[model samples]
Target: MIDRYVRPEMSRIWTEEATFARWVAIESLVARVQAEHGIIPAEAAETIAATPGPDISDVREAERTRDHEVLSFLAAWTKAMPDESARWVHHGLTSYDLVDTGLGLAMRDAVDLVLDAARELYRVLARRALEHWDTICVGRTHGIHAEPIRFGHKLATLAFAVDRSLTRLSAVRESVAVGTISGAVGTYATTTPAVEAEVLAGLGLTAEPAPTQVVCRDRHAELVAALAVLGASVEQLALEMRLLQRTEVAEVEEPRTSAYQGSSAMPHKRNPTTSERLCGLARLLRANVGAALEDVALWHERDLAHSSVERVVLPDSCNLAYYQVTAATELVDGLVVNTDRMAENLGATRGRIFSAQAYLQMTRNGVEREHAYRTVQQASLRSLQQGTQFADELGKDGIAFDESALDPKVFLQDEDVVRTRLHERLREHGTVTRP
Candidate 1:
C-alpha cells in the first residue's frame, strides 16, 4: 500500500472506540478461557463474547462520573452487556490485566503500520543509493572538507542504519505483543496461568513469562527505545539534508514546490523546511525514551505512574515515528540532488579535499610520515591563504605527485564490500541477516 494508508490506519488503531472494542474483546476472551477452565458458566461466556463493546460516547460519558478509566470502561461495558454476562466481565482481573493486555493488541496493530512506513522508507533510500552509486561528492569532518566520497556512500550509510533500525523494531514489536492476564500482584490467585495462556492464544498473542499487576514495563521500554533510535537515525539524515541545502554548500535541496512558502517576510526564501521539521520532531521521540525507561522501575508489584505517562507517550511515539519516516521518504524521493553543484563545491577549496590522497602517496613513495604530513599541511595552508591551487603550491614545494592522486575515484577503490552489502540488503530486499 501507498504511505497514505499508514496514517489513517495507525490513527484508527489507537482511537477510543478501537480501544474499547479491544478491551472488551480481551475481557470476552478471558471469560471464554475462564469458562473453558470451569471458572465461569459457559452460557455467560457465550453471551459476553456475543455482545458488542460499548459505544465510545457511552464510555466517555461514564468516565465523567467515574474517575477510574478502566472502571468507566467496565461501567459502559456492563451496561451494554446482559446482567448475567456483565457480572463476569472482569471477574478475576486487576485494572492493568485489562488495560495493559488490551494495549498489547493495539500496539501490535500500530507497529505493523510503523513497519509499513519504515519499509517504504528503506525501499526509497536503497534505490536512491544505487542510483547515485558513482556520484562523487566531497566528504567533511568537523565542518571542514576532509576527503572525497560518493554521494551514494552517504545514502548507503543511512539505508543500512534504517535497515538495522527496522530489524530492532521488528524484534521489539514481538516483545511488546505479549498479553498478561495474571491477577493482582501476579500471584494468579484469582485466575490460573492456564486461563491466561488460552486467552492470549485466542487473541494471537504470547504470554508475558512473568507479570506483576501489569505487564512488565521493560517490554514497552524496549519498543520506545527502538523508536527513539530510529528517530535519531532519521534526524542524522535530515541534518545532512539541511547542511547540504545551505546556500554556500548547495549540494542538495529538499523537495519544494510552487505552493511552498518559506519565511513570511522574505519572499525569496526557499528554506529546507522539511528537514528542519524532521529534526525538530525527532527530539520528541528521544524525550519519550527517558519517560519509558523511568516507567520500568515502578514501585514494587507495579504502580499507576506508568499509566498516565503511557497514555501520552505510546500513541505519540508510534505516530511520530511513522510520520517522520514517511515524511523522510518523501523528502528523499523528491530531493533535488545538484550534482553539478556537488562537483563545483568539491573544487571550491581548490583541491584541498585531495590533500589526504597526496599525503598517502608521499608516504608510499618513501617520504618519512612526519615530513610528508608537514609538507602537505604547509602547501594546503599556503594555497588557502594565497588563493592559489594546492597542486601549484605542491609543485613549487618540490613535491612529485602522480596526477591520479587528485582523482576522486580513488575513494571507490575499496568499496566493493559496501556495494555488495547494498545490493544484498537493498536490491534483493528482505534477505537481511537477523541476529
Candidate 2:
C-alpha cells in the first residue's frame, strides 16, 4: 500500500492498483445490485463477482493509452470477467458511479489511517504534558517574557487543539462517505434510483440524495479542509518547539542521536529539523485547501475543472497529513525539555518579571495606582540596563522605604496563581473544553 513517495499506508490509499481495485469493487457491487432487482441475469452478476480485478501493469498501460482511468479499468475488467457477464458490468452506470464510489472507499480507508495516527499523537502529547506538569518555563507574548507558565500547560493546550482536529476529521469522514450511482445528470434517466441505493449499501456508504455526472464537490472540499485544519494544528505545536529551541531560548529541543549530523559547516547544531519539516509541509496542506475551495465552484451541475484538481489535491492532502501526524507524534514523544535552563533563563532578567505582581500588591495595599506603576517601571528599567536585581535596586533607591517593605519573595508570592490555573486547564490532557 505504500505510495511511491510516502509511507506505505498513505501511499497504498492512492496507488494506481488500489484505485482500480476499488473501481472494480464498485462496478461488481452495482452488477450484483442490478441482479437482485431483476435488471440483469443473476448468473452473470455472480460470474463478474467471481473474477478478480485487473493486473496493475495492464491497468497502468491501459490508463496511459486511454487517458481516462475508468475506461482503462473497464477494458481490463471486461477482459477478466466471464465473456457473457462482461456486457452487464457497467450497464446503465456513468463514469462517476465508479469514480466517486471508489473515491469514497479510498477516503474511508485513508481517514482510518489518519485517525490511528492522530490517536497515537494524542497519547504521546498527553503523556509528555503530564510528565512536565510542574516544569515551569517563561511565558512570552510578542516574543518577550510575560510570566511563568508550566510547560505542561502549553503541551496540554496543543493536545486539546489536536483532539478538536480529530473530531473535525471524524465529521468529515461522515460527510464524504457518500456514494453515487446516479446517471449522467442525476435524474436516473438511464437507471432506477433504487439501483444507486443498493450499490451504496453494498459499498457500506450512503447514496447521495442527488448527484450529477459527478458527486457534489462540496463533500470532497470538506474532506480536504479538515486535513488542512489538522495540519495547521500540528504546525502550531512544531512552531512552538522551534521557538523554544532558538539560540537565545534553548528551553526545549528535538531528540538527536550521536550519529545525527544537522549541518556540515556548524557541527554544533542540533536543530529542530522534524518540527521544521512539519511546519513546511503544513503550508502544502493549506494550499491544497485553497484548491479544494476552488473545486467547489465548478461550471453548472458538473465540470471537468474539479476532476483534474481533485486528481492531485485529494491524494496529496491525505498523504501529506498522514506524514505530518506521524512526524509530530514522534517529535512530541522524544522532545527534551530543559527544566534547569527554563529556571535559569527566568532568572536571567533578575526578578523584573514579577514587577507587575509587585505593582498590583502595592495598589491593593492602598498605594496610589499611578505612583505604584511609576515606582515598578523605574526599578525594572534600571535593572534591565544596569544588570542589577530590580528588588535590590529598588531597596538601594530612596523610592522604596526598606528591604522589609519590598520582599521580592512577597511580590513573587503570586506564582502559585499561574501554577493553579495551569493545573486546572490541563486537568484532562488531550481533551478540549470551553475556556
Best by lDDT: 1
Worst 10 residues of 1 by lDDT: 426-435
lDDT tens string, model 2, 292-367? 9899887877778888899899999999999999989988998988988998887878877777777776788788
Runs with alpha carbons beyond 4 Å of true place in candidate 2: 1-5, 60-66, 397-435
Instruction: Give the per-residue lDDT of model 1 (tens digit) for 1-435.
Output: 134323676777777888888888998888888888889999999999888888877778998998788898889878867788789889989988888888999888878888888888887887787788889999999999988888988998998898889899899889999988889989899888988888898888898887878888888989888999999999999999999999999999888887989989998888998899899889999999999999999999987889889887888888888889999999999989999999998888898888888899899999999999999999999999999999999999898777787888886798867867887775456644321
| TM-scores of the candidates in the order shown | 0.94, 0.90
Residue 124 error, candidate 1, Å: 1.2
Worst 10 residues of 2 by lDDT: 402-411
> Candidate 1: where are CA atoms >4 Å away?
1-6, 431-435
